[model samples]
Target: MSLNSTPQSVRVHIGLFGKRNAGKSSVVNAITNQEASIVSNIAGTTTDPVLRPIEILPIGPCVLIDTAGLDDIGELGKLRINKSLDVLDKTDIALLIVDSTIGIEKEDLSLIKKFNDKKIPHILILNKIDKVSDKDILLSKSKKLVKCPIICISALNRIGIAELKQCIIDNIKEENTDFRLVSDFIDENDFIVLVIPIDKAAPKGRLILPQQQVIRDILDTGAMAIITKETTLKETLANLNSKPTLIITDSQAFEQVSKDTPIDIPLTSFSILFARQKGDLSELVKGAYSINNLKDGDKILIAEGCTHHRQKDDIGTYKIPKWLKERTKKDLIFEFTSGITFTEDVAKYSLIIHCGACMMNRAAMVSRIEKAKELNVPIVNYGILIAYLKGVLDRSLEPIKAKELLSVD
Candidate 1:
């Protein structure tokens, strides 16, 4: 990924959803002004969700997800429908395409209900308006059926395309604002220390996403970022004229970094910072307390945002589970999921341990957290859990001192 381009995890996610042959794909192509999705007269042409990253005039960078039709039939159709619904978890805004001639169907209504339940911003689109004789009457009927902003458009003929684009921009602006990764914590000329350990698990020649993003944020704030490994931390600190404003380390080195750094200096981890950036930080801290309540044979879910070959001492596959069992003194059952397979039945798990989610967008991470909350399951990320296990979780959170961190166990 280029430094100039926006990451997928930070982009606004817009999902297109409707029944089979409602022109969902057509609408996507029309709005993007590109053949982003395959359009066909046959039903269920889109088997899975197709994502297109583009730059809009007002919205900046956004991801347009074209999902499978909700009204698909048979066993395969059921699977496709489930996939379409799964897209809802990552959608910041949704577009419900309704065939003007046929009006809204039961499936479309059910989809709208889902958007309401998820609290997702949405626009009801009456497509194929060219085929209808009375477009105003059709749009008025749509407004009466669904309590959302309704727009009439002919996707094929490009009618009302500009208006729909503006609607998307307006709704997105209403729903979101800019947030910083680490710039808010420091000011111009402030010195920040970042401890990054290069072990076998670390990538060969590149810094991880979180570290790169943090450094970029610091530079953007006109602050000086000093990078060092855990072994050289003391030497690096001694060379600085004044004590650093903050110290950020990889979660694996929290114990040593906490000991080497002075008591007055604030300390934290990349994952902790990302927890605040990508998801609910307080919720994850509360979930960390669940570790102390685990029993032997309790099922724990270990989820990673990206997949890679597991080394002998892999953090997720080996290190975390081993350390967790040792800390709890229990024979815990562990299950794993990677990439886009997070939408599952989480009720069976005692707790969920997620990655820092540098590769995932904010909407996707929040959706998973929301799912855990709905199922009455506790969730924590890799850094928080590691800090808790190392007996330095509280110390690592000293910088933020959020209300939830104040009561952490």
Candidate 2:
């Protein structure tokens, strides 16, 4: 859960998926009023998925995801198409862009079927309406396949964009603003002890986004927030109330924090809340158990969404890999992939571990999770895996009412 009891990833994720040359990028640029993705007549200009976070007026915070063309040709095209379909896994809303002049084709219909199968809420955009003489015919044909609101627009001219956005706002099946953190686990003025280790890996001056977000959420809940490193946790807690409501710590410090904090107080890591925020928490909890069954020599893929240059000891590459190796004792041939390299071929790997993904949108995360499930591979995130390796994964999920929903044992 979030610092305020809401999931960490409560932002809405909207994806634009359709065949190439159908103005998918143009539509995204039009909706967002910025050059979010590159547009070209080329069949496969967009190879990897592109994501942009925006605050639409009256719609709140949302992430827009742009994917490759589904109708790409050749061997490389097939891979790109697979990746585009992968974006659908976590998409809360899908915008199907259709070339109004050419009308709906088989490729567009395939995406519609997939969206239906995923049960994702979607909208149909009849793009390039200005280039068509018979706009009526296009609208009539599209209504048969998708019953959602259809907006006719010339993305090049910015027509119907406001209406389209308003429709998106109206279609939101769920809306949450108060989005709180773990404060609900405590009393009005109860204490929430946050254990943060000032390791070399900690950012130069500022706290990481997750930690900062937690602090803000705690303050928002009118609770007493005490932050300290592992060395200061014991003394800090001892100086506080007889019982703090909840204690949250970075997964990397789980073992030390667990050893220091008494069991009566509820505890969990930043990752457990993130798992619920960015992906499916329950499914990941279930997947975490499969880690125990992992044997030596098992192939594992540790995935990171951001493509930034690594520091001396990067968490995704150096830290997690070393931790897994030490715990598993298996000569595991681990592989690492970046944002544009995620694929659904998990059959060859024993497990897949990902990061917090502040750089990636919710749709992309969902897509990766769905692919791992399709390959029948156990997938968990950095926070979850770190807590598990630290031997305190259980206490980390204490605030979740559904923590009992999945027993890792």
Most accurate candidate by TM-score: 1
For model 2, the superposed segments whose C-alpha errors exceed 4 Å read 1-11, 19-26, 33-53, 65-90, 130-137, 156-158, 172-188, 308-315, 318-326, 402-409
In the range 1-409, model 2's lDDT, one tens digit per residue, is 2223422255677889888888989988998798777889877788888877777656567777889888888999898888787777657788988888888889887777887777777888889999988877778878886677799999989998988898788776552222344544555677788888998778788887778777777787787778999889989987875788788888888888899988887888876766766667766776767777888788888888767778868888888888877887778788889975685467899899888765555666777787788778999898888877777777677677633355454
Model 2 worst lDDT window (10 residues): 1-10
CA lDDT of each prediction against the hidden true structure: 0.88, 0.78
lDDT of 1 by residue, 269-297 (tens): 99999998888888999899988889988
**C-alpha lDDT of residue 48 in model 2:** 86
TM-score quality measure for candidate 2: 0.81
Q: Which stretches of candidate 1 lie over 4 Å from their true place?
A: 1-5, 173-179, 402-409
> What's model 1's overall lDDT?
0.88
Clash pairs for candidate 1: 9-361
